[model samples]
Target: MRLLHHSTSTDRPFHLDPAPLVRWVYVGRFSIATAIFVAAVLVWQDALTDTGKLLVASLAFAATLAVTAVSVVYSEFYGRALGPTFHYLQSVFDLFLVTAVVHVTGASSSQFAALYILVIATSSLLLPVGGGLLVAALGNVLYVADALWSVETPFTATVWVQLAVFAAVALGSAWLSAKLREAGKGTEAVLAHVRLQAADILYNIRSGIITVDATGRLLYANPMAEQLLGLDLDPYVGRPVLEALRRIAPELVDAVDRSMRDRVRTARAEGVISAIGRRFPIGVTTTYTEGDGRNTDRTTTAIFQDISDQKRIETLRLRAERLEGVAELSASLAHEIKNPLASIRSACEQLSRSTFTGADERTLTHLVMRESDRLSRLLTEFLDFARVRVARREPIDVAELAAGAVRLALAHPDRPADVSVVCEAPHGEFIVEGDDDLLHRALFNLLLNAVQVSSEGGEVRVEVEDASVKQLDVGPNFADGGVALSVVDTGPGIAPEIRDRLFDPFFTTKPGGSGLGLAVVHRATDVHRGHVFLDTGPTGTRFTIVLPRAARTMPRFTLGTSSATVLT
Candidate 1:
């Protein structure tokens, strides 16, 4: 019975019990008991010589076997149909069978007389308190009747004393069995409640959980697991998990199975799962285990967790690492080339200072000058791309910085005569925490780019808007609170292919352009922890810059001082 109950608890494969295995155990026990009775009858034939003994022995044996067989049949095929009331009646029948066996064997002295108490005790363990007590009471009544009927003479003192003792023992056993059964029930109830609470907790958790057996059968799956797999729970259980997996993701099954067979306690794999026509990154982790020594043949448990967000973060981290390496290489190359370029520029200046005689000499000098200027421009662009140094940040008025950039842009040799610079902002100055020179340079580049892109007589609108910090969706690390400076142009818009790689070094669309203007802007934005965005369409190109605001107590950098050279 104990083994049967244990098997029912742990080994049953289906979700619900459509057939009760307990009935088969009862039937086998009934057959053994019938065989014992038959053997007893054959061995004790002499003792059953009298008519009373013959009738009692034959009737008791037949009655006990009949009751046991009936119990097994009803419990197996008709238990659910019988309902609670009929089930309780079956306990009554078992009590009657035990009483008849005690009466036939000898009311008080027979060894089998104690069998009635055993039956009652067993009944108490199997049934609820009301049913157990009903059987116990029935056994007590039968014991009293058997004792009274076995008396040879009426009202003997010794006979009465024996009857009284037997009755007391029967009652005592019944009460003890009932009390023990209640205690056992209480303990089971507490354990069941705890298990239910644990199941609830697992279901409500946000992290995905899937537990599979050694046979590749999914034994347990939580709500999160269902959502992650996009499976409905009702139809998922008891199905070959691998077959179901092929419908969702086939790659996972092979990896998970391999990990389990190799006794791999933990391993991680990543892939993409298609959901609603879109691909989502999925991370799978498997854990394996053999059962405890007591249940060595039991199934293994593997828990899976989803880590898509973590995978995305790691991917971004690797990309940033690559970008850093490229920046370092560019900086190294720029540094190596700048020293020689400086010497060449110095030698050209010396040649210009010397005497020139004819047209050919003048033309040679002019060529040297133009080539030197080109070399200088190339060196500047390379330095901007390298951007090796950290920012020496301080507080500066954004409006004043914008004014300085405008002055520098207008002073250029190729400045358009019809181009106009306009600033639309609040009267009170807005301060930003950044390197003034880098900010000036970035703004100057953007203004120069805007001027070059705009047509003659076109207005270059420069607007500084102060509001709560908002992030533009296009760039990495773009989220922060800051003031936005927009330089809007009226000219031919940027091409689609060029917009994607605008900040890339040495990429340009203009004929004689160095192609470092936007790249330099990007580096300066990085230094200040700000962001730059370009929106180009059929109308024109709009360049927007965002910078973090500085607190009032910080000292501010203004024009025309030793610090002013730093902003030049």
Candidate 2:
């Protein structure tokens, strides 16, 4: 079967949606008839002289009913030509009906004459500017003719006054209604423009944006979000956010819930999401908006991006940096090995001479053995620095970690008894996510350096502070959260010249140092996505490691023997 389609003019500029106008038109017609019938009843109860007025009222009601039925039929059936033409026809009929009723009752003095204003206002709203003015003029003509041809009242000064008043009301109402219609059209146009611009931006922007209501129901999502999230989101509006995102990223769903439950104003983090049977990196940021007034209606807006490409680029950049470092380290290693090999070769040659005494032979042998051990230690340090990785990450207590590191540093046989090691941390539990053994070795290196550098009887302090309350320059990336672990020592500060190479592999001031301690600390902190900061002054030197917190809160894990791995 073929279906018929009807076009509407309401889509054109300066026209309104006709559905509401049609409804109001029906209501107005019915209400006017009811008012007229009641007025006639009161006149009849008073035993009025003119029975003709009652007849006119009955006729008006019938006419109004007939017109209302015709308009409704045209709107429902024909559908076409249901615009200004229908509205103007209704206005013309109302003018004549109202005039007939007024003439039959009392032309100049009829109370029902005031109903002209209602007709004028409604007609003006429904019609265009010129069409409404035309309607008003026609109603005025009908009213004036009624007053002039009235048989019950003379056309005296009173009639002229009534005519003038009616004309003024009609014209004034028409002007006002026209202005109102223009304003409505202007508002509709502005709203349409804004909506179009908003849609354009939402679709074109690169970042994926999703807006969820207070109950975690999805309200709106742009095309970018659908593409990046790998979901057909057109039909997902009003669905639960978890229902859509659970398969792809349960962790992101949990993050959104946490933001709502905790009432956090803003949060940011990076995670891996599984979508389309593949896992990739994503960076998520949530902004919470609170509703005004007593009944709280909060909205959470989450903006995210597929960062897999960016992460791939970062990996390549880091690999390039490591390759460049390896080249430099190889040169440094060759220079270092040449000196040790030369010392050992010289010692061997001396021992091979027959003129050498027995004591001399023993000294040469001892020199060769020392140089060989030194070479072995250097190679081990290089391996440790190159192999640093954070494989198993878990939450660890800050205080216990600090304590273990300090104990290990103090327990060293070569440690000076005069130097004291202390761990200062808040009484509250502070658990941070990181590789357990890696962090321990990192902290141990910092504490050991502090102890070795401090003068006899000097104090070496390991301080752990929550970054949420304290001052640290980790930048906006970690501004939302983090903890700082710092090792401070009371000793002569590092010289400016040597400070630049403090963390350089194979560069150290100590006589027998392999110089990989600070480098290992640097690598370990980097693996946990943390930063290292160093402050050296005339008083002392301080080394700080700042690490961000994890989403899950795990119990404290004390450092056991397994945690004390030598980076070298």
Candidate 3:
């Protein structure tokens, strides 16, 4: 059956699917038929004993069964191929069924004639706008003819009143069903828009999201989930994913299991996962919902994100607070001991050169003076660490400063024999707002250390560049736009055990070393509102100084000919 070719003001074809209404109608028809058949056979067997009437009743039952079966088969296989034709056919079947009931039970006087009202109301819902009216007209004709054919020539008042009631119901039912169909169309449009909006949000959210059914079968996993987990999760959908989840993150597995088995909800919980050979922490939350209050029909959802960078920033903040305390103490202690230490060194030197001193005495005095000098030198380095300050703030070209430091470090006496050096800096000025002296000293210390650590004939690289957001992820949070000056060395890497203590004052492994080189570098960077990062392992070590940029910059100064001075 086909729907009427119709359109709205927009010229778009408009039709409502009547399949749902048809199903409800079938259920109601079956119930009424069952009740009538049972009453005739058991409750009113004597009244229903006429041979011909019994045959009609038997035939009606079979026909009702046949029509319902055919409708079910057609609905499943043919679908909407016949459209309103199917609706019209069902309306006609119900009309005949109702007419037979009225005829067998004494025409217009039978209360079963009211079944015509149900048929008319249901037809209005299942048929298109005007199809309802068309069906009502035919029903009215059939009812009037049945009443007149089964009775005497004179028309009765009861029959006339019944016909008037039928007409009124047909008009009212058609009008009411038309309004309901319009409301249904508007509701479907709103629901479709909501579904699309929710789908967009679920797919594009930053955090990973996953859903699983009560049977532990995976239902949905967003794109971010696969990206964060570094796994092909799509293949596991509709299959059990606990095994895969357990391998990458056992903590998440426990959360989902608890939700599915015990209806537990995990909120603001933390877990750890290792992906791409790097271990990082993840924050997780899990919630489960039961379908229709069923214990077995549960669904669990888990949301999680990798929080490695967040954790690092927190650690850095705590570490900075501790180091600030140490710096204050270092400055005070250095000031208190400096004058007395100077007097002791002077007294030893005077005794060593006195005429009355014996040869052995002179040797001992000289040794004392030399030892004092060495102590004095170490103290001077401590003062440098304590005195890390920005003497002048300017938009200095860091590329120029790094190139100069690389040159001075290459010529230093401490550099390993035949060790080569490479310096990479962008053309023109790469500027940051900081004291030239402090930044230069920090850059020089890193370069000197790198060159000193290199094996004979190994390479040391000095690189300078503008820091981007990606690089700043591991740096201090205070730095916005910045410059990165890095010194890399090819040599035996630092031991993992002592890596944490590398910046601690007097923490050293080298003989006759002050251990204040990195501490000085750290202090200098910290004072400039920047940070230093040390990457060291079995391969080698790299020290990077990330200094925040000035409020503005320009290609104003070129290297080698400007008033800018590089300090070591």
Q: Which candidate ranks first by TM-score, i.e. highest?
A: 2
Candidate 2 minimal-lDDT segment of 10 residues: 559-568
Model 2, 308-363: lDDT tens per residue? Answer: 89889989998999899999989989988999999999888877776888898888
lDDT of each: 0.61, 0.74, 0.72
lDDT (tens digit, per residue) of candidate 1 on 438-462: 7888888888888877888987877
Ranking by TM-score: 2, 1, 3
Tell me the alpha-carbon RMSD of every candidate.
Answer: 21.7, 9.8, 20.9
Error of 2 at 522 (Å): 1.0
Query: Which residue pairs in candidate 3 collide?
Result: 1-82, 1-85
**Winning candidate number (lDDT):** 2
Alpha-carbon error at 125 in model 2, in Å? 11
Query: What is the TM-score (0 to 1) of candidate 3?
Result: 0.45
TM-score versus the correct structure, for each prediction: 0.46, 0.64, 0.45
Cα-based lDDT at residue 133, candidate 3: 77
Please give the lDDT score at residue 395 for candidate 2: 82
- Candidate 2: give the clashing pairs: none
- Winner on lDDT between 1 and 3 is 3
